[model samples]
Target: MSANTPMLITFVIYIAAMVLIGLFAYLRTRNFSDYILGGRSLGSFVTALSAGASDMSGWLLMGLPGAIYLSGLSESWIAIGLIAGAWLNWLFVAGRLRVQTEHNGNALTLPDYFTTRFEDNSRILRVFSALVILVFFTIYCASGIVAGARLFESTFGMSYETALWAGAAATIAYTFVGGFLAVSWTDTVQATLMIFALILTPIVVMLATGGVDTTFLAIEANDPTNFDMLKGASFVGVISLLAWGLGYFGQPHILARFMAADSVKSIPAARRISMTWMILCLGGAVAVGFFGIAYFSANPDVAGAVSENPERVFIELAKLLFNPWIAGVLLSAILAAVMSTLSCQLLVCSSALTEDFYKAFLRKGASQRELVWVGRGMVLLISVIAIIVARDPESKVLGLVSYAWAGFGAAFGPVVIFSLVWKGMTRNGALAGMLVGAVTVVLWKQYVGLGLYEIIPGFIFASLAILIFSKIGSGPTAGMLERFDAAEKEYQDAHL
Candidate 1:
């Protein structure tokens, strides 16, 4: 009956679908393992889509495009970095992690894997790594909430608080109920929606702007520097952009998908599928931002052109280019991207709290049912904290995501790499690496004042710490070395 009715209806249906999937997944969950990792039953398709959806977040649709729109070719470097990082992560880390995690005491979380992988009976590895996941993931989840708030605020003309809750509600509801299976299944659907919206919106925008030639000319005419790949880009700045890929190794959520795949053998197919999807989706998102520059240059009065938030470019394009009904579906894709990643982050946080902290220390004898409910409760607690952190209406999604990404990349990247590949790496080496990496990121961000991204320095320092500590301290035990060798051998045999 009204102008906003169609959009409201579309959102209701989308949210409902997410909830129903959660309910279905809830029914299938039988134990703590099932709740945390879907009992490692994920097939190739679900594993691929879920991993891509979780890794990309709304950053792919909004932040990347916004960067492209605001700057130019310089912004594309982040995407290039991520693509390379993700591929390498799949190639080296995915299968090895899958096999080794299962082999090394069936580790259900990264922290758990570390303690077992290093044969650390002190449990310091688990505790410290869990703390890292909790701290960084909260910031990561808050970034998603901020993205959602912006979307709802623009779509409904609502207050930021209302939009914040509205943006987070579906994600919280689904993850709170369904756990890992629900998150993975819904991610598949959301990933498909995301791909369609990315493909469709770019096509419509290109058509509206009259084609590639016209758009390029408009971009050059509006600002000639936008075309130069190295424009205003320094060595440090370029390196910083490329270093974003390093974060992939340490990302708990993405690695969780690899750990959940039905078998190590399935990873090759999942890797192929995910990489293809990532390149296409990433390219489309960049096109939206590049074209937005041209489209808005020609028509300055368009809603998003002068908006305070440049991230609104994708949504504004959907609204201007499509009818109300189609626009509603298109806009929901933004919500899809937001919810898919948010749910995964929340679920991972839940696992860290329940599996690492509660079961490991607070209640070692806790029943499976009790741990599952405790995890569900943690989802609620963490979501509330994220909402509070995201309350700042002026916050930029890309800025928040960047800080969290660097934090994880620096903190866990070196440790994860060394632990998997270096048999001589000792437990103390792992501890030293994690501490140096995380501390370096924080201190570098605060005192260094350098133009460099924190991750570069953090990663280097962490890697060096691991190597130096391993050499000075007692190396890994014979058993640990043997397991490492077996895992690598199995990986090679599977591929061959």
Candidate 2:
């Protein structure tokens, strides 16, 4: 039998289980609301894990570990920034967004919330926000695709072209049929598998290296800078790394988790559960990369695959150090990571086309069944577009993710903050912030010589534009103020 048979069976079984979940969710889905947002019915456990799973993506397993493997501990500044940013987002934005979106005409998506929040009569803000989501999210989805492609190429020994479509097929099938509930439910299972793999792999590596002390000694022997967090890091570069948290505010997929919670009351518990899971998972990822440094240094003969692609450190290690049956389970965690994020991103893109464009313009009176079908069709459309974007075989998972992450963080972060908190914020202010944030990231990424991450500059410029524009633009209308005030009170009460 081929050595790849066990892993192949694992992949087939996992994919089959997830598709079964989609079929199960499809039976429960009744309308457009159920299709896109799960009818706002997720509990705290589901919400927490689904949010964390969708947020982490294959970036957590492949991209993050790869960076640490290549660069050492200095790269972990990004992890620190992400943890702080995610905590703040949960504390401040999650519950408030839940209450506010519900109050604002039960808005199913961010564009819908923004339209009602500022009373944008011209629907200009709605159209613009939806467009921004499509653009950045398409890029974001491409990152997931690239990560998936890498996994398949490395594991199944498939050609890059074949892996691209093959890797995407299962995620597309589940998401196309079942929508948010399937994504969320499957996320919960995937999150469990991811944590199990992350925790187990690092511990096994540590034991193989003798212990923590011996592991560090091996790492130090390979490169002393691996232990030095500040090595070659400037103040600006560090700030840029830390700014990853800023993107959480504007992430439509994570925000949808907030929106789909059964009630605002669930946010506190969910935040606690989610944060604990995130910290552990991130720590484990860093350990896998850092510890692999020691493991590979000792066993250089078996390190060929990992040396060729640092991102394969986890994959190579899992296959090398564990029994084939066990390695298959661990490897499935990586697939889970890819599918969880890609599935949600596809659904969000589908929501944008179906809710923000098709229903908003072409068919205001479209029936619920028709809208659900439209959402499924949009999922297929976006998947094809993202596949096209991901056609480049040389794409780096972290590089692509950072670019798309910056675009969303800059474009929508400040606008979300101001709209939710500042009573004085105007529709024009939101417009200004979104446009400036997005454009700055694109321009800075393409032309700027600065070594800093684009998110810091993009976020700063976007905040300034919102402040300046809001000052010059009109204040919130009475109804807007009333809704905002009422949502705030309800949010506070839920927390208290």
Candidate 3:
């Protein structure tokens, strides 16, 4: 048999299983809510793993490792920042979002929450927030597609376009059929595959380099600077890397995991589980890249795949170190990462269009059955757009991820923070904050040459905008305040 046969078989099996899960979820999806948000019935295990799975995406396997492989330990600063940011997001945002989303008209989408949170009868908040989701998520989805394309191209020796569509096919299949429930459940399975691959790959790499001690020696021989976290660091560069954590607040896909939890009471357990998985997986990714330096340095003749594109470090290493059967499973982990995040993103985009745009304006009295079909249609629509965006074979996963991450973080992070905590936050305040945050990120990214990441300025400006606008504009109405108070009370009650 050809060397690629086992890998091909493994890939086919994984995709088939995901589609079967989607079929199962489809049978249980009785309404639009279940289709989009799993009817808010996810348990702690599903919620925790799904959130982590969706948040990490293909970047965990491809982009972050690549960055570390290219620049050494300094790149690990991004991982540290993510740990801090994810912890804070879980502690402050998860439970509150779960409860607040429920209390305020049982909001199934962020746009739905915003509309009811401040009682925005004009529906401006719903329209704008949905637009923001669609815009940034399209770019975000493209990053996942790019990562998938790279995987297929490297493994099967296919062209970029062929790999792109081939990689996207299964994801679209399961996601289109099953919706949120399928995405979440499949994410749980995918999360397990991802962690296993990350942990085992690094160990194999360490062994291939002789041993831990020998690996370090080889790394030192290659360039001792690889061990220094501050080897070529700048203040702005470090801060920019860390700022990735902030994006967690505004991530529609990750936040969906929080909202779909069975109850706010599930949050503490879920948070604990999520952080543990995240830290281990992140540590493993760092190890893979760091140790890969030694392996590649020692075997420069076989380093062409990774040398050409650092993102393929993990893929190249897996193929080289493991037997064909084991390598197939390891490679499937990359697909797991890609599918988990891409499915959630597609579902979120569909929700924004179906629940926020279609139902809100186009068909206020549409049947639940009709809405589910509409959501599925929107999923196809967004995937095509994302595919177009990802057509450029030169696109880098990390670069694409960073831009969309900044856009969402700067635009929605402050707004989510202020809205949940402060009853005083008015609709105009949210509008202003979203505008300032998004605009600041875009302007800073395009025009500013400063060493700072755009999220820093965008977040700062957005927070100020919320405070200033809330003070100047009329405060939230009596009904909005009552809902906020009730949600807060419920949150305190849950903890107690």
Candidate 4:
């Protein structure tokens, strides 16, 4: 038997528990609302944790750590930008999105909300938005799958393909069965586990390497760039990279939480809880990476042992620092980070397909029972496709996530923000913004050799599209303008 057998067993048990929780959630699902939004009954804590867990995902473990290891303190700016963006999203977008969605009789997905908001009864906007959701979400889901594959490969010595499928299947089973409730509940648990892992691992690694002072001194002596926030080799690149926080405005998975939130009043609490969790968790992850550098430096042999795969920084630390039992649990925490995210993305994408497209256009007469089946079917399909894409093993989690994030941010971010804040935002303007934003991201990623990240160009084009299209295209209809004004007034009064 492999020496890591105990850790492997723990991971298996963790996967089983997640699937069972999903099954439990599935059993309670009696209707579409229950499956999609948990009947809008989620409290602030559940909503907050779920949102933060899903948002952070593998990026927190792999991307953030890798950044700190390779770059340094500059990586923290990404966390700073994200924290500020999240706080503002909760403060501004959450309450109004929730109230307006319910008022508009849209209970399902982001595209559905857009359709109802602009009174796009013609279904053109719905179809276009659904297409964007599916395309970008497929790529987004692929990134999470890559992270899961990496976790399995690093910990269990499993083949990437085998781990990829196992991770995908486990998340799909739960998400398909339990829907939103299962996703949120499991996310909350996973978030707690992740926090524990982040906090505990760093402290232990630091102690094992003598102490923080000794460790920091070693890092400084070994590589001065490791301590310099700006002069760090990839500092500016990382900051430009982390500033991708602006993409939060349009992310369907994140914003959907706002829509399904119980009330605007609950939003502030959720915001506080989520931001605190992110700051601590993300900060800990960065610390883990930087500390891993010092720990490995103290024992150069351990660094050579896992030389080929720097992404396995956390896994290597687990084996070096903990007993089999604790390592087992820590392994599960990594899985939690990966799976928590995959489950949420799968649900959001499935909801977009079933509610926004299938029900809206393809099968208008489909019953709730049939729609539930359709959602399950879509979840299965997306999981398979993501697994196929993940087979390449070369697509870095951070890169894939960045592309998908920028695409969604460009396509939907400006449109959503303007729709909520600008009464003059027209259907034509929204459509132009969506198309321009999405296309700009794709083109910039593909053809632009400018060397800057695609997100910078994407955001610029997206913002421009919204501004120009809103000005040049037909203005908002009179009735739509009136509704916007009323919604704005209500938002102001409620906050005031």
Candidate 5:
């Protein structure tokens, strides 16, 4: 047996345990509700941690770290923006979404909520929302697959294609079996593991470099600009880039957690827990990246010293600081971040396809069993497509995630936020807002090439589309407004 066989065995066992948990979750799941939301019984910790873990994903491990390594402390503004945006989402959006979704009799997906809330029993809203989810989520899920593949290729010396398939298969197996409950439970565990790993790595790296002062001096001496937050990037560029936080208002997976929370009362606690977790973990990830650059720069001749691919910062540090046994566990945390998100996104996309599109229109009579199978089939198909897209090793994880994130945020974020707050938000206005927001993001990413500054354009276009369309377009029907009023009243009374 190979000397490293124990490490491989441990990794395999960890993955097997995840799949088994999903299988067990499936066995215990009695109905679609159980599969999707665990009967909406998640506590504050589970909901907050799952939501944060799923939200951060590969971006936390690879993208954030790489950003710090490349751009220095200026990247911290992104963390600041995200934390602020997430706080607002929890404060304003979470309680309302959770209560209103249940009050409206929507149980399954975001499109389901849209149809129920707006009284658009017609198929147009459902189909449109489903299409948007599918389009953006495919690219979003592909970015995650790319992160997973890169982790495996860099750390385990696996082929990129092989790594892609392995990662996809693991994520798909669990999500397909366990559904939302499994995803949430696994995410809770994964999120905790991620926090531990994130914290431990940077402290170890700092000790390896003497201390913070020594590390900073080394980095500053190596490249003075690395110490400057906004030295290279312009003021406008910084604001525009950090505004990526605004996109969170519209993200389906994150908002889905808001909708699925057990109650409005859970939101405040969830918000506090989630915000604290995001700040610490994201800060730790950035430190890992910056410290990685310092560590490697100081010791260029260490065995397996990685230089060019700054993304390897985390993996290389894991290997250098720990034995293969502990490194394997640490490596799984990276995979955990990637898989937790991929699983959630895949299920979300599949639900949109199966529930929103297939059942809503194509086959109204589709049985739950048949729909379940369809969702599983869609998961497989999407995984295959993501694997195909993840072949390009040079594809930047941050850039891809940023584009997808901005697309969802700009297209859906404003509409979701305003729809909840404004009684007069019309269906046509919402539609227009979503279309313009999505189209604007795509055009900006493809044609504008504004680098980190693209998110601002998308956000402005989306917000304007919502405001203008609601003002000029046909307002909601009297019946729709009446229903909205009733739902709002019921929500208030229930909370009160």
Candidate 6:
């Protein structure tokens, strides 16, 4: 219809493929478990890719790049922190959580896991954790929506309002149809596209500017601090940036990949694959940002829009450097990164609604088929809410993401780590840790106004709360401690 016809067509075909994958998954989904966790049947590669895709989100393509574009190498500490956190998560939390969740009441969701893990008969853990997830994930999902909106608006010449809703349509359709299986399979494909795009774009941009040496000349001439990793960096800033890795221990969507793995033996392989992919993808993302400084500096006319909105660096570069078809595919990779995570978040929210709230509180005997439809319905509902939340054209993807990441990291990170290792963790302690972690994050962000990131304080306070409350409140019963030991033994035995 216009000059953007090819890109639009590429996007259409990609979106259609995602929907078809969902339909295929729909056929295989036999019960609620299959819909929520894909019957715990994912292999190592799929598990790794899905986890990476979901965890990285549009932050990988847009937010991270934008940060580097604006702030230079100093912004890269976030990536380093994320990589370290991801490695630790895979190493310490993955296999143990997989074995423990399966043994501890076969929990289907994070809230369910918290409830069963602590043996809380009162259901406070389920309700509170579910509420926390719904609150933060709604914001998290909105960030993904904002990323998609930016992609569509930049790539197709659409208004932000139209792009916002349009971007969510395909993600909701596929997630509503296929459930977890569809999300995972589509995530695998999207992950490959994202990696290819990130790798190819940076290589092209680097060559276009002559080479690394020439690119550095351009960047340094334009702004010297772009090369200085420690320029204007403070001790507090460095610690705050590095603390992002702590978020990994409590990310429900990433942890879901571990829960859905076909077996504990699959974890080590999955972890290796995931870390390798993460390193490559994160490096590529940072390269795009760093090289963008050189590319834009050399071409001021083309950099007009990007200078104003740094987040558009990736999209603008693809358009300027590549032919229409190639750019379409590259832009599709941005869409891939956005959709992959949004769909996973929506599905996880759906599971929380269906399994955690709907069934837990209402319609206790709902059939598997009915539950499946309800999950689908919630997926649509949550997507609409996220769309509404993303209506602010001024919303920064990274800003929203940082808040939600801190919320989850502070609320659940310390509690998750302690619960997994410390058999003495009581229900009151878990509750105290979650409440203190979440509340402190809020207060620190809103009131403290300390230049430091909230997660640093929130995480520390939460860990202290758990330790203190565990001592003051009733400790875990002997039976619960025995079960914890048994699960720990089973995990170690399998690894051996």
TM-score of each candidate?
0.96, 0.98, 0.98, 0.94, 0.93, 0.97
Q: How well does candidate 3 match the true structure, expressed as C-alpha RMSD?
A: 1.4
Off by over 4 Å in 1: 303-307, 394-401
Candidate 6 residue pairs in clash (backbone atoms < 3 Å): none
The CA lDDT at 459 in model 5 is 71
For candidate 5, write residues 1-496 as lDDT tens digits: 6535655776788789889889988876766666666668788999999899889887788778888987788777788888888888888788777866776666478788777766775657778878888877887888888878777676667888888887778788999888888888889989988999899999999999889999988888778888787867777777876687887888899887877688777888899999999989988998998887788778878724455766777877887888788888888899999999998899888888787878877898977678777887888888777766677756564356657888888878888888788888876777777788888887877888655556577777777877787788567877667766776786677567
Residue lDDT tens for model 2, 363-448: 99999999999999999999998898899855553355667888888888899888888888888889999999999998998899
Tens digits of per-residue lDDT, candidate 1, 442-461, equal 89887994899888899999
- Residue 26 of model 6: what lDDT? 90
Q: Residue 303 in candidate 1 has what lDDT? A: 49
lDDT of 2 at 19: 96
lDDT of candidate 1?
0.89
Task: Tell how far residue 322 is off in model 3, in angstroms.
Answer: 0.8
For candidate 2, report its TM-score.
Answer: 0.98
| Per-candidate RMSD, Å | 1.7, 1.5, 1.4, 2.2, 2.4, 1.6
* Worst 10 contiguous positions by lDDT, candidate 4: 232-241
Q: Score each candidate by Cα lDDT.
A: 0.89, 0.92, 0.92, 0.81, 0.80, 0.90
Q: What lDDT does candidate 6 reach at residue 470? A: 88
Give per-residue CA lDDT, model 4, range 180-272, as digits (tens). Answer: 889988999999999999999999999998897998998887788877766643644765656577778888888877877776778888989
Q: Return the lDDT, model 6, position 149.
A: 87
On a 0 to 1 TM-score scale, where does candidate 6 land against the true structure? 0.97
By summed lDDT, which 10 consecutive residues of candidate 5 come out lowest? 393-402
Which segments of candidate 6 are over 4 A away from where they belong? 394-401
